[model samples]
Target: MSTRPPFTLYGSNASPYSCKMRALMRYRRLHFTWVPLNPMEMASHPNPNIRALKAKVIPVLEWPDGRVLNDSTVIIDALEAEFRDGRTVVPPAGPARFLAKLLEDFFDEWLMKAMFNRRWSSEVDRDWSGRWIISDQLMSAPELVTLPSPSQTSGLIKFFRDRQVGRLALVGCEDDKLWQHVMYEVVGALDMQLRSGDACRFLLGPHPTCADFALFGVLKQLSLDHTAGRFIQDHFDAAYGWVLAMDDLSGLETDVDWKSLHMDTPAVKKILKLISAMYMPYLVANGKATRGEWVEVEFHLDDGQTFRHKEKFGPYQKKCLDDLKRHYEQLTAS
Candidate 1:
């Protein structure tokens, strides 16, 4: 049993990042309480700490001392430092570690477009997911004794669905053709990796890494929704099974040698190649655009395709790109 005070995890089932952090905490064997919160109520939450957070995002980790932390990647890193458990999502320092970070960022930023595209694009998906999300929030209410009636949540569901659909273009999900192609290729690569051998079960190696969790965050939603779930079930069985395995790995044991962790497999190389062709150009272009008053960010992929987003440049992604570069530069010959 944990001798320390239990941390409180404020999140929602509708959120992939929330799911990601929750699974990570379980895998690390951290003592914590899961408090499902309504995403719509985050801004005016009764807890001062939630309201005071700069970014009103889910999976907010409230430390035992009452301080709060947001951002799944940031929260994972913070907890890795605080907990001394042998189970770590991060690999040892080396090229493998850097590749892990790269894959994590790629899933978080690029592949996320696929999840958003599928979740809010179709009428069937919109109606089902939106209603389910609102109902999830209602069920989490402390005073609620039974399932929430649709009459009580219909308006909120419609509002939430419309809001998400309206912002689809901002996140570059408006181009269905582009994102669909990207998703298919990435999932194919991951499926191939998982089927190669028992050693290739996880992204980096036999043990789960931050990259695996990052991919889990986006794919978790994909495996839940209508369209994307069908695609995974029908075409990528290995990838689909991998997602279920990653959901909860609390009992998983890690006895592999750290030196064996690597990123040279054929499937991993293909994934890296895709990242170079897709995410790298977008990162460089966004970094340049965010530094100035740019109305849209445009970049050309290695395959002679162009991606153009009319939304304002994203400074957070720019920071992610910078961090990746810094980490790459810090690596030395070994």
Candidate 2:
């Protein structure tokens, strides 16, 4: 039997980040109890440790000693440090590690727009997701293993749907046409990467990385929603299959041969180009706005179109950009 203390994951099934952490923990073969919680109620959670969380986000991991940690990326890194097991999500340190981190951020920050847009933009998806999420929360109660009655959740579902749909512009997902194109391009590139060879199954190599889990977090929803799921099934078979494979990887084991891993595939190149065109500009703009250089984030895409968001700037994203830069600066010129 393993000597590691069991963890308690407070999250909801509807949350992509929650799914990401859950899959990461599963892949690491860590013993943990999954406690599905509604995000709205997190601030007033019964557990004092949960209530003390500064950010009311899903996938809050509670260590056995009662300490709590949020942020999926931070939690993954912490686990990687705590567990010296061979099943690491981070690639061997070097360019591969940096690339993995970059791709992970790209998926988390940019591709997520596609996932959110598809989920809340359409009538069918909005209704289904709202009902499903509320039901998931309701059923999370130990006393309620079955679905809640519509009458019990009707008002809550409508509130949830309208609230999410109302924030489309805030998250820069108001432009359905742009996000649709993004989804198609990203899914296509991922399909090509997956089909490149057996070694290209994951983003960096035969083994999965933090990047793969991050991509899976967003793609998992895309493959489940009504509109995007159908689109993915019709156009990107390999990408859809990869999402399923990433959901559970406890049995997956591979030799840690860092020298064999390569990130020069055509699909990766395409993804990097896309990031340069889209995510990089956005990050730069957000960073500037965080530094009071601008009242809002405004950047031009490679397609000669300008994108602007007047909503509150994401300080966390600016921090992410800074962190990426710091890591890049630390790399040696080999």
Candidate 3:
């Protein structure tokens, strides 16, 4: 008999990271309770769990033994190690394993700006997302479960819009096109790779890996956001189909051995080309800036496009690169 405390997840529907954690939990077939938070609770709740997170972010997991975990990547990594013998989202070893982590970081970090802009840049998206968040999250509480008046809804939209716009500006994504371009290039690459002959149902193989789920979280949001959904349907329909297939968790729960599978293949290479060409330089420059160094970088993509940016490094991005390197080192050592 297992005495492990039941796994509990705290997050909001509006959070892509939460969706990532939720989907992974579903794929793992772990029994857990989801505690979705409304904006009020997220901001003002007195829960020590929230304070313990330090970042005040959702998608924080409460482990059975009373340990609280933060960040989707950190939470997923810890859980994957704990349940390594079960249906896994990462390869046991090899280039495929590293590629999976890289793709996950790409989706989690780079794609996030686009995801945020797509949802908050436009008035239509802002209103839609605002309504959805309030309805879905607030309704769970008896005291907060009523439809807001038109005026109240407008107020809520403005409130969210102001906050999100500030975020976009701070991230240097004030120009919606910056994030839009990121979305366009990534989806364009994904479309081509998925249509390639060697393309599997999932990114890494026939099953979903961290790469697939990480991308899935962002794509799922894009599919739901009125603006991004139309863009996906109009330009990269193939990638949209991949999103639907990855949503099926029941199909992934099996005894198949990931180590026996050949993971280094053409499909992965195509995806890696985009990461190395477009993401690596930016990541490197960002890392240097984090340590108080100034940098100007020119990043070129596999499709012969180039982007040059002069900026200071970001702390969070520095941590992302460090985590990726740590994982790579561990994989090689094993």
Whole-structure CA lDDT of model 1:
0.82
lDDT per residue (tens digit) for residues 1-334 in model 1: 2568889998887788888998888888787899987655778888898888888777899999998999998998898787656787776577877898899899988888888988888899998889777777777888778875778778888898999999887666887777787788788988988777564777767788888888898899899888899989999998999889888888887764667676786567888877887788778877888443444656566678776655557788899999898778766644
Query: What stretches of model 3 exceed 4 Å from their correct place?
Result: 1-5, 38-46, 175-177, 196-198, 260-267, 291-296, 302-304, 310-312, 331-334
Candidate 1 shows a clash count of: 0
Residue-pair clashes per prediction, in order, are 0, 0, 0
Q: Please give the CA lDDT of all the candidate structures.
A: 0.82, 0.81, 0.75
Ranking by lDDT: 1, 2, 3
* Global fold similarity of model 3 (TM-score): 0.86
Could you give candidate 3's per-residue lDDT for residues 1-334 as a string of tens digits? 1245578898777788888888888788766788876534655666676665667776878887768887898898898889865577877677677778888999988787679889888889887877776667556654664666767667766786678766765554555645777788777777877787867667656677888789888888888888999889888899988777666585555674676454554545655666777678778878767455555667666566666555445788888889889878987887
Q: With candidate 3 superimposed using the best TM-score fit, by how many Å does residue 149's alpha carbon deviate from the native?
A: 1.7
The residue pairs in collision within model 1 are: none
